[model samples]
Target: MEGVPGSSSEHECDSNSLHSEESKLRLKDAIKHLEQLLLENDLVAPESSGTISHEAMQIGQDLYKSTVEILGSKMFVETEELIMAESDDEEGQFEEIQDDDDSEQYMLPEKDKSMEYIPLDYKIKVVNMAKEHPKWTLKTLHKQGCSRLKSMKHLYRWEEDIKHGGTIIDKYSIINSWTYDRFVEARVNYQQVTTRNLQEWALSAASQFENFPFKASKPWVIKFKKQNRIKQRKITKYVTEKETATLEEILAAADIFRKQTQVLIPNFHKDFIINTDQTGCQYQSTFNRTLSTQRAKAVFVQHKSSNKISHSYTAQYAMTMSGKLLPLVFICLQEATGAFGSKVKKAVDEFVKIYQNVKVTSSKSGKLTTYLYTQFLKEVLSPYVKHEKFLLLIDSWGGQTNPALYDDIFQDDNNVGTCTIKVIPPKCTPLCQPCDVYFYRQVKNLIKRLQNCSFLIEQKREIASREDCIKIHAIVHHQLSAPIFENMLRYAWFASKLTDEREVFMNVNEVCFPLDILKKSCDCKNVTFIRCAHCRANYCFACFYDKYHPSTCTVPSTSTDE
Candidate 1:
């Protein structure tokens, strides 16, 4: 008996080696045909020397390695089939329901499970084993490598199904496999593919099949990720809020908006069509990067105060199609009751006189509310209406879109004509809204640089008070309003795809601090202290401090007073 067992082990080893050789031969032939197909389809890119690129070679090697690994692994058997069937088999069985109210459900398609499939060769082997050993029980068959057969009844059903010419492959299996391939392709291209993205892609690809039942459920995602060796990782690249829609969708909406507004250009002159929006400004914006020793272990830069980065004020800007920034900027400072306290109001009132172009007010959130928006239209926009009719392009913010906000223009006895409002599509602001496309970034750049200069030049450590922030806002707006920046303002519109005419211009940083300009002496004939953002002049520290610049205010105990 011992000698017989030894002979059987040797025979099994020989059989396994034969199977391995056959699999290797088949894989080699398949790879050869795949290479030929790739060449015919022009899938592999060649270098100038007419040789395959290194990238292409690397890709092919990776594919070959993965195929070899798969072929080396033993075929999986569904050992749990009996348990699964038994659990669900009892018709009126009471099952415990688990609460899942807090969990979010996704409708992504399920991954193709190998267990759901039985290879034709394996089926034939199992059927032959049963017929040759007719007295062998189901447990005996399972111990002999027919582990996936749930019961004798299942074996009989499989025989009948195969006798009737039914296929071993499940319906829609190929399509489901293709959907997974598409996901892998998308992931390789650096797309931040979400569960929704997978679901949508699967549904679109499977739409041709009737009643395809893949929902891309949570379980499917788990299995698909595990099988593909994918891991969830944080995105290192810059991303924006525009992911609500695809690039094509955003571009299409922008094109529609451009066409719609272009038709009205002839009716309203360039100066009469205005684009306006509000942006939040930090009191003391600081640079997130700075100079340090090349091999330093760590780097640190000091900020004025925590509130400088945490608190913000709103500044609204209006620019016409003629490339002119409206003369005034409407500013709303954060305060309770949407109005400044006694002390702060007095300081703001006095500051506005010095800087006439800034109309300062207060709001609870420092955001442009409907009430504050109406005031902006009246105090800032109404004064600039030179034509009988004008067009306004704004975002879809609730405050800006209020119908009552435009009633004054239509109900005017002064024959001001009708004011038409065109809203930029939702989530399309980054591509179609002029202010968001280019203007706000430039403004923020200016704010951070100015704050850094104050720290480096004057050595001020305290946070920029509300008054200093307002002053900085005025200076930045005043500088941007210059005739020199006209083309830059127009470029905002062009960049947003609202205008066809392209205007080449430098942003605030490049224009203000050119190497040649920075080399020159100040107007006071001394070393340049800082470029006066308000007057656009170079002044020495002494001259600027005594005459041009205001003394830094004392740091307040809190951001705002009651």
Candidate 2:
């Protein structure tokens, strides 16, 4: 009232009322502006789009950045139960983890009885039955008198069940697929009993169901919900230390491997290796058809856990190359070997090719072949090693070793310089090998790719039938034979890999590779990196003369065309 110079008590009331009206008009303008923003955003409009509000966009950007900060590096999200495992005591870990998941009831009356749970031998019986019939049903599984899931309390004790016709390859694949911690996860993570998804009616070859007991034979998905939801994430903080190769190395390797896998097409490697080795690609006048497509005879899966790695060897001779650094040949081999009625001699040749050795006192040809992979170490890896000094990693298997493989690779009549073959400390391979850290990446992608094919088939058929095997094999060959996947494998293995795998071995982990270029490194840290030739996967030993690579992998690709 004092500020209104011309106003007395009556006039002051009118002036104050006008001021309040002006304030109400400003508030109405503000509300109109907000409503306009909501309309632009289309949050309330059915036919509107491309109208994100500035405030809303900012919020979304913040969420995306947070996700990248936490989960961006990995292709797969770690199930939360694995993260929460620290809170559980050892004794409580073994309690039934999935009692609520399966609707099926345990029928065995003596399941928990001590006497019936004795571990027994069953390999011969199991092998014979599988070899004889190629597939099994619940009736056949029951004939073996193997302990049902009700009979055993621990998963490890089921090894005997695998021996008899009680368990089949699918179960073995499932068991071997997970790390020990994952086995504990299988036991603890869900409401349902974790069974092999392959044998269940989930996959494509359902009508041809092998009706096998749940066993770990190959890798399969373990689907469980943490707090009951499919947790989507982008950023992951993995525990990092210099114990072994980090998961980054493995993923990068797989990325390289996935890209470089044109080896599935075939190679001049047989002829090149023949020249390199001064011998034919055959032993005893037998030409090996196994390597027709570029592939490893056996994958050295150095299963590292708690500062130790158990070198679990799986053969993939009949398998085709899906990748080099991260393993892809395993699943393919399991499928192909099961199909086409694969043979044992071909399998053994694959074993012999991986490990090299001199003859020993054996009546069987006076020599038994062993995997002393010193040759690849000597010829290909030697010149690229660090400081003229390098580390050789191997498992604690009692097979012929490659100590000599590393030490004196270059032979001379005059004088041989010193060399070193430093095997990584036992059980430390997972920490040391780059492959372990990154396998799940491309491995899952590859599985997802294969799963896509399986799902596309007619509903009348699924996996493990004579027809499904052929169809899946054809699909696998087509996907792998594609140039994109093959180039990734080649780029990752030959290009992305480091001269020394050690993290401290010249800051190797920091040496990252994009899909475009991989800057290679060697000891003295000399670098030599390669790029794609027109971004195509096919490689020719003779650049100009030969139009196509070796005709072996290119064998008309009837499957791809089909």
Kindly give the stretch of ten consecutive residues in candidate 2 with the minimal lDDT sum: 274-283
Per-residue lDDT tens digits for candidate 1, residues 190-237, read: 457765565444443333233444444455556556866667777677
What's the TM for model 1? 0.54
Compared with the true structure, model 2 gives a TM-score of 0.25
Segments in model 1 whose C-alpha atoms lie over 4 Å from true places: 1-244, 294-297, 410-417, 454-458, 461-463, 529-537, 541-546, 549-562
Q: For candidate 2, lDDT tens digit of each residue in 1-562?
A: 3542233343222334434665546535644544443443343453446787878677765744432322222211121111100112223212332234332353445533322222223322333233334233323434444333332233223332432212223333222333332333233323122233221212211111134323222222332223123333444444336324433443354335323433321332211110011100001111111233357666342111311111111211111112322112221122222232345435434432332211111112211134323434443344333233222333333342555543456433444533422233332223222222222223333322332222223233223322222233233333333443442333222221222111100011111112222233322232322111222222222221112122223323312100
Please give the distance, in angstroms, between residue 551's alpha carbon in candidate 2 and its true position after superposition: 6.5
lDDT of each: 0.61, 0.28
Error of 2 at 360 (Å): 22
